[model samples]
Target chain A: MIERNGLQSGSQDPAPEGALLPVVQVGRPADVPRGRADAARNRARVLDAAQALFAERGVQAVTMDDVARAAGVGKGTLYRGFGDRAGLAMALLDDRARAFQAAVLDGPAPLGPGAPADDRLVAFVLAYFRFQADHLELVLESEAGRGPGARLAKGSYRFWRQHVAWLLQEAGAPHAGTRAEVLLGALAADQVRHWLVVVGRPADAVAAELAAVARSLLR
Target chain B: MIERNGLQSGSQDPAPEGALLPVVQVGRPADVPRGRADAARNRARVLDAAQALFAERGVQAVTMDDVARAAGVGKGTLYRGFGDRAGLAMALLDDRARAFQAAVLDGPAPLGPGAPADDRLVAFVLAYFRFQADHLELVLESEAGRGPGARLAKGSYRFWRQHVAWLLQEAGAPHAGTRAEVLLGALAADQVRHWLVVVGRPADAVAAELAAVARSLLR
Candidate 1:
């Protein structure tokens, strides 16, 4: 579902002509053609177990032992699939990121591609805030210890900036790319989480204000 | 200096039809004396020490012991003076907050009193981002654990929100108070720190984008 949505959403770039899309494909030369049925099943089991454990005990508290037992797989199999906690966490975030990408890119108008730029931007920011609220610990852990939200990759960050940039361009921003990068930078996941979650305001309310701010900032 | 600026700025609503100037104390509460010179001097020394230590080690790493040593005061004296590290941090934030309040409320035109509502709002948001950058650690720690930023009452979160609310009302927002609350809620110190310090954007750039966004949202 996510893949289908991702592809459709990816096409929403009304770039002037032939602008390259920014998705980072990590699979490469040494990669095998495909996983066997059993391997795929194990992967799914591990992911399900990891998500449940993370939700219950938080990302920091859930251990590989806990995951192995919950998934009904041996510790060795679990390690083989995800290597370590960070790897498992990253895998989970990847699933979410892909899901989120699909929602914004292809799910519907407004959040997707069919609506006006201003409305789309508002929808996307709202969606982003909702996602952050739902996975607060996961997102915070992903970016913690090195300073809040320090580990999010540049490419991932660019994805958001690009989304905002597209909207800004649609909004007739004087400098779409640069302005999008700057404006969206202010509405980061950690920032939203801090305000709506940490600071105890309703997430939807803050998201609405953020959307309004985005509207104001863009052209 | 701040009192001088407050009178000069006149940026805020006139002080409730001759509400005694902050300088003209109408009443004094029990336990808190009208003023004490020695206590004020000690407070200044401790704050100066905290500022110096903050510059050297940043917010996270500095300890109360370090603060005491830097200030050439005993640990007990430090505690007596500021209660705890959190208290000390809040005091520092208070210093900046008070300065900011004076600047925005009374310092000069545009940010203070003389400019159009739109221009003042833009300047205020931009000034806010700059303030967050200047005191990143204290700002983050203030909103650190969870819930409302109640712990950091020493800072300008409430004040900023109220100011924005007033501006929104002046700019013709229906339910201006609620709108301002949402707007200020959208721009917490944690979010600004996450973007500027953690995400590595220049403060000025973030300010400009935010100012633009504020303009658009208000419009």
Candidate 2:
């Protein structure tokens, strides 16, 4: 609802927004493909429509009804499928977040697991920015309402923080836990958003510099 | 203007309502203080009133009339002195920003200019948190659009970024410029605001960790 100082004439509060989805996982779901095909297709349709709407009108301007109409679905179907706007946003993050986790966990050596921590940290940072460059709007959407992505994913940030702490431990430093928290906090999504979007800094350069800075900490 | 989301709020873009301050410098005169003793007292009364009103009701809720009434001054005099709400907010930032700058630039060796770059980096970060600890609200206010403290002096970040980059260079890594940007960007005010206010992390602990992270990066 924050308005720009100069836009007095255009000033207005935001819409009747409510959080729909549970962003953080309360419990682990089994790996069974439980979703019906029709549901999956409808979900895809809604997401596609929502992405287009978001790009054109912004995350704040678009409503659930708008999304349903864009997807050629009834409003009930849209709500049934995703619960609400926040839920829809969370669903969008599911695939990307998993893929990101997998990339760091098992994809390749540097960004995965085989390389040195310093090099892996660099690769991870570069990959993070690369993902951000590709999926800026989607990533930002999940961050709405200080919702799920705002918190530590038990398996995600904890894993990375542990990795960083281990690296610092290997480097023979004290306060590894605190150091990990600091590193993760510094490398947070908000920082990425500000740098890439608000400050208009080039992503590749930022990634390189982030990596270098990470190296400096460990070296 | 931005009312609660439950209301089908008529696009009350709260952006311009709360922050009415113009982005211009204020109150300088060619002659000696133009205001008589009474005028000086009135100005002080207005400032005190503004701060109290802002504290009781957020910056958004307090109107110029409210400020004028609280200060026991005419609304016209208030406007003459402050121009607008945004200008008044900026005025508040003046003393705070100077103190913050001094804490970084001249307070003590670790945070000041004389220590090793690595230690200085740690010191600067801790100092940033200390500033936040004392003036969280002002810090937050200045961060939003065209708030009083937004237009920081030239190279405000440069001083810290260069310090970090120079540390990297001293550690036999030459191209530290972009790295410095990333480092500084990661730890900038916006990120701090999210961490301290939204995420609810303890500023003191985060500050300590930040210093540790800086040390790890430079060590």
Candidate 3:
């Protein structure tokens, strides 16, 4: 297991700490004990339930009690697993971010490996826009009041910045570092929400526009 | 005088409300009363003193008492005018923003009118980057805890967005609306602080790169 750093000290996820790393089953073997296996199942169920509830009714409208009820778990169990609403939101985003990272790291071409840098960059922007569109509320909740630069501290943000910079460098783009930050800045959750909810732009249209802009920057 | 809208209801500036409009001296004739003239002079002194102290010692390091002393105004007069540190910062930003807006509206060539759209956009980005660099700390303080999308509500932000959108439209860029938001997102004060402070990049480098990217989008 990777050693937990002070950066994620605020995290209450029961899972392993490294944000970009795969969630490792450290001690559990194939012959897992019944109670431990049950706990894992319960965690998955709770997450699924929370995701559905949040998507259906919005994050603010759903409470811990509601999450517990939807998950078929007691309030005590829910509280023990995820300390609060913020903790649950963080955990949920952590889960999705890890999966997304995995796809970018090892999945198909363009978003993954074995594609031209410009194409990969375009794919990455489109995928990230969709990710933000899907989880805009949760991302906002997970990031709220953490100060403006808090996102820069996230492992996921650092990973994305590095990946984008790498792609731009591979594409021989000048000022890759600053350009990566500018590209990611466009995907900031609050800005996405403003475009989607406040501005009432269609998600596909916004995402396509951003993708086009990303491709243009590489040119 | 324009009616004070609820959008700037939070504003504490004693000056007239419209952010883009020049500060009109309502009811003050050419031959103004000595007392009112002195009050205007004192206000200018306070703002000037605050700006210098903030630049020299950083916004957080300086206090209202220092501003009062530096401006040679009483603490009571300072507090009565500005309400608190935040209020003072807002007023300071408002003063600067108005001046910047004026430059954009009427000042010479690239930054003002009578230039190609692409050249105007590049100038706007460079000027905005310099503006953020000069006032990073105060902008951060004034915007703290106001929410992620709070900047969108600012009259100055709206004005800039419209101006950028107009430029993009004139330049025949597709999705000018979304592109304008993307361009302005790069100039978000928090992101600018990250680039200038956390990333330790020179303001000129960052500004130039952004200007280049802005020019690219118009192509």
Best by DockQ: 3
List the TM values for chain B, per candidate.
0.70, 0.61, 0.70
* Candidate 3 lDDT over residue span B156-193, tens digit each: 56778889999999998887888898899898888889
Candidate 2: regions farther than 4 A off: A1-45, A55-65, A68-87, A114-116, A144-174, A193-202, B1-50, B57-91, B103-110, B113-119, B144-175, B182-206
Model 2: how far residue B58 lies from native, Å: 7.3
DockQ of each candidate relative to the true complex: 0.15, 0.24, 0.52
Which candidate order results from sorting by TM-score in descending order?
3, 1, 2
Q: Write the per-residue lDDT of candidate 2 for residues B120-185, one digit (tens) a residue.
A: 666676776676556655544444333111322222344455556776566444456654544564
Between prediction 2 and prediction 3, the one with superior lDDT is 3
Cα-based lDDT at residue A142, candidate 3: 61
Q: How close is candidate 1 to the true structure, as a TM-score?
A: 0.63
Cα deviation of B200 in candidate 2 (Å)? Answer: 7.9
Better of 1 and 3 by DockQ: 3
- Cα deviation at A110, candidate 2, in Å, is 3.6
Top candidate (TM-score): 3
- TM for every model, in the order presented, reads 0.63, 0.62, 0.72
- Alpha-carbon RMSD of each model: 9.2, 11.3, 7.1
Ranked by lDDT, top first: 3, 1, 2
Name the runs in model 3 displaced over 4 angstroms.
Answer: A1-57, A60-88, B1-88
